[model samples]
Target: MTKQQLFDDIEADEDWLTGLSTDIWENPEVALQEHDAAEALGDALREEGFSVEFGVAGIDTAFVARYGDEGPVVGTMGEFDALPGMSQAATAEPEPIEEGGPGHGCGHNLFGVGSLAGAIAVKRAIERGDVEGSVVYLGTPAEEVGAGKVYMIQDGAFDGLDAVVSWHPGWTNAPNKGSCLAVDTFSVRFEGESAHAAAAPEAGRSALDGVQLLGNGIEFMREHVADPVRIHYVVTDGGQAANVVPAEASMEVMVRAPDRAAVEAVSDRVRDAAEGAALMSGTEVDVTKTSGMYGVLPNHTLGDTILANMEAADFPLSEEQEAFAADLKETLGSPSYADVPADRRDEAAEAAMFTEPLDAPDEGTTGSYSTDSGDVSWTVPLGRFRAATWPAGTPAHSWQAVAAGKDLGTAGMLFAGKVVAGSLYDLLTENELLEEATAEFEERKGDREYESPLPADADPYELTDR
Candidate 1:
């Protein structure tokens, strides 16, 4: 009935949560292909009397599970996608469980299971009549490659949600008041005449030339763009034989900025450069928008709530857990994270729990990466946090991250679950929280409407293989 009881409910399901995390971690699947992960978690929720809906947003791996029939609907987002080539055993060494294989480098194996534990705890509370609202478990897939949540929003999957809470694994724990960049991924393909290199070479219009020119144009454009704008590309199709005048070539281009308008502005220029390259090379070029996500609209109201629960929750690490974290810390290295203070780094490596203070969301702050949750945040007032699943200095999408997550991340996952469950309890019981979140959501959204950066007909799932 009380918040402590809600925490108890989460602790009661520790075995189930552990099993879920272990299962998903052992069988790593990359974005949009988390079939086994989705099924295992879905069945677990269904067995607990939650109404489950699969393929809600036309994404085969995406699903929704809900408990309770009335009152405010508090949704928690979960992702199960893993990264490629980050396989590692849960040891201090940089050894892979399967050399050159996929692994939970981003710690989504813990992420998905942690969020599920929170949602299920809320379901238990609802059954006890301690809460008067519904709990939603969003089974989001393909966050690494496919923007699964963005596609879900396009299909109205997030409609009628009161608030959405999220969590991720990181080197430090904090209420995530930080922001992520808005990003758009697209493709450009060039087609032209082909001929023998040695014979009639003058008659061939090289598509490879167009692709090279386009790359050159983008590289030249970097100096003219805003400081925060990031543009990168990869040649997916750069022709076959060197002796032949290549007839076809393609490139995958990605543009990211702090806001939607900036992303749009840079993307338009990239498109223009592609057209110019085609014109100069005497080749035809086709451009396609693949996927995108918006900047996260962090709600201070929801953040304060989650922060309180994060600090209030008991996250004691055992002696063995501390040793495990220390061991993993030895394998971690990050040039980007070089600025972390030496004392903080030394303490965080062995410290059991709690380091960062709960602070107000900083204005104009942005992280270098992008998440589809940013798309979901634009749709609703969202709160996201991080648990110290890995030791200090661990960088995401690496063997070190994948290594610590194998078993050392279990306690952190449970800690996140308790915090989330506790926060959901307050959201259900406190009307002022939702009212404030809604008011802030409207004031911040202003005239800006939610728009998909992808083309109208683009299939989000098609990019899963990448």
Candidate 2:
């Protein structure tokens, strides 16, 4: 079948795909608890005659579904976790389906389902003898916490894949060739002797003082770090009562940089500041390394192939979809055509790619945030694409994102699913393409080996302890 024919077949199943997206969005499972959502997708793949492996990587919500057994094993990734407190129903206005519950603020619900649709469609093509080689769909969870893909890679989940292609639901449709920052998340705890504030104010060493000092020291270090380094923290624990000299206090810190070495250097400075804080306040300090991820290694071969497929694919938005997007744009307090670059603003006004990559802010415009997908790109020839799902300038992890995720988000998901399916079909049928991507992967990897950013013996479940 022609590529357009294949895309049309998948698009014909839009209703079923939409139902799946809405169901997963309504459930709103968090991180490793994505069992129900994973199983639902697993069942769909199994019915389509794909070989399904449940719990492949020691992660309950992680699995791999595959079809065909020949050369050039192409893998497509799917994520299904939701944000902490964005539970909104499928409405134009923000209305929580479950008050203060989990929601798809990041649009991962559609991410997983749409990817499943793509993999299943490719499986059908292979079954009909239209394509050669195997296609595998990886069910990855907890991307919001920035460690799901890291743990999956560590478990040797993607050991034999020739190439992997994935896409994210966003406010535009473009192939991303930029890198994301590597990050480490850790916590520092201070301990001291507690005493009655009124009776013996001078006798007790306050742990809260140590915490404050640590924050102050970090503020000073901020001015000295590299230009692109970003360090942020939240006070996870403090004194329980005002009258009691706090015996314990804790802070969670996220250290990020353009590359692994830079992140490590900044992290060491943070550790030293914590130590200095303890010394000055006469308190004991304990540092715990929680989890970390590497920066993405962009592959030109894979990127160009996906970009070609994206340019050739059909991504027409409906009028209702455009109206919803405009409504979301107004709600975000951004110009109806605001954040779109000057060149793309006119196209956006004409309802084109909302924030095209050609108009992307910089080579590393997304540096302000980080993701575990960076870990995946280091191991194989991986490519990421963005499809406009929200208004032009709506920031992620907001009520506006949640509202748009129900409609426009699903449209982008469907568009992205077609892109992945088409690209994988090409790889499966064309051995030369797979060979080129693998060669590019080797050239980029050089002498470095894939390493899990997570510390030895660090459990993924530790995220829940906080």
Candidate 3:
């Protein structure tokens, strides 16, 4: 089949894709609790004749679906976890479907289904004898709060892959060559003697005092670090009462930097500060590393492939779709163009929904957020891009994003599906493309081997409530 035929196939399956995305959007699940979401996608993959495996990496919601064998393997990731307390109806103004309920504020409802559409299309291409390769769809769960993919990588789920492709819902359409921050998430606890505050206070060693000192040390550390470094924390356990000296206190900390080394360096100093705080307050301290992800290893060669397919598959939205996006844009405040190029800022600011693909960012352009996909890129050649699933100025994890996710979001999703299909077609049919991408991957990875930051006995179930 020709690439155009693959595009046509995705268009023909639009009704099914829409229904699948809508169902997941209607019933939102959070983090590792996405049982219903995983089952739905797994059933769909089975119906399409792909062998499905559930509970990948010991995470109940994670799964893998595959088609074909004995050839090049290309994979795409689909995340389906929702944010907590972000429920909203498909309206311009704020209207939650259920008050303080979980919601698809990140448009992951569209994310998983879109990637499935692409993978299935590639499967069809493989059957038609146009491509001689396998199509793998990774059903990634708990991207919002839990790094399910990280554990999946640790379990060797992504091994033996030629390359991987990914897409996300966002305000602009672009083949992202930019990298985001690498982050280390951890928690610290301080233990000390408890005594009455008003009586025998000198006999007490305050755990609260250790937490305060650690916070102060972090504040002072801010000045010594680079501008991109971010250190933030919340006191999960402070004390029982002001009258009693706390026996124990805890703080969850997150340190983010441009890359893994930078994050490790900052984290080491933070741990040292905690130790010093505990010593000063006569308390014992314990540090636990919860999760960490590497920065995306940007591969321009793979990015070029995505850009080519994106530009070639020129599907613009209908007037009705544009009007729908325009209405949503009206409800939200003006969007930021700080990440957009200076010359294109005006154009980006004016679009109701940006369909035209932007140029890739320059080297050293790092975004402020992090993703579990970053860890996957370290293992294989990965291509990442964004499709406009929300209105121009709409931010993620907001009511406006949830509102747009129903209809306008689906349009962008289908666009992404076509891009993925076409990109995979090229990777499967063109040997040099994958070779160049692999070369770039190796060069960028250098000699560093991927290592999981979680403790050997760390359980992913612990993240379900967070």
Which predicted model would earn the best lDDT?
A: 3
lDDT of 3 by residue, 1-466 (tens): 6799988999999999989999999999999888898899999999989999998889988999999986699999999999999999998888999999989999999999989999999998888888899999999998876467899998888998899999999887778897988998877899999999999899899999999999999999999999999999989899989999998998888999987999999999999999999999999999887778888889899889998888877564778878888898888776677656788878877888877887675445888899988999998999999888888878898899998888778888999999999998899999999999999999998999888766657788867533
Q: Which stretches of candidate 3 lie over 4 Å from their true place?
A: 200-204
Q: Please provide TM-scores, in order, for all candidate models, with all chains considered together.
A: 0.95, 0.93, 0.95
lDDT per residue for candidate 2 within 297-332, as digits (tens), equals 776666777767777777757888877777666666
| Candidate 1 Cα errors over 4 Å, as ranges | 334-346, 349-364
lDDT of 3: 0.88
Clashing residue pairs in candidate 3 (N, C-alpha, C atoms within 3 angstroms): none
Provide the lowest-lDDT 10-residue window in model 1. Answer: 332-341
In order, how many clashes per candidate?
2, 2, 0
Residue pairs in collision within model 1: 31-142, 32-142
> Model 3 misses residue 317 by how many Å?
2.7
Query: Which candidate tops TM-score?
Result: 3
Alpha-carbon lDDT, every model: 0.83, 0.80, 0.88
- Please state the error at residue 48 of candidate 3 in Å: 0.8
The candidate with the higher TM-score, 2 or 3, is 3
- RMSD to true structure for each model, in Å: 2.1, 2.3, 1.8
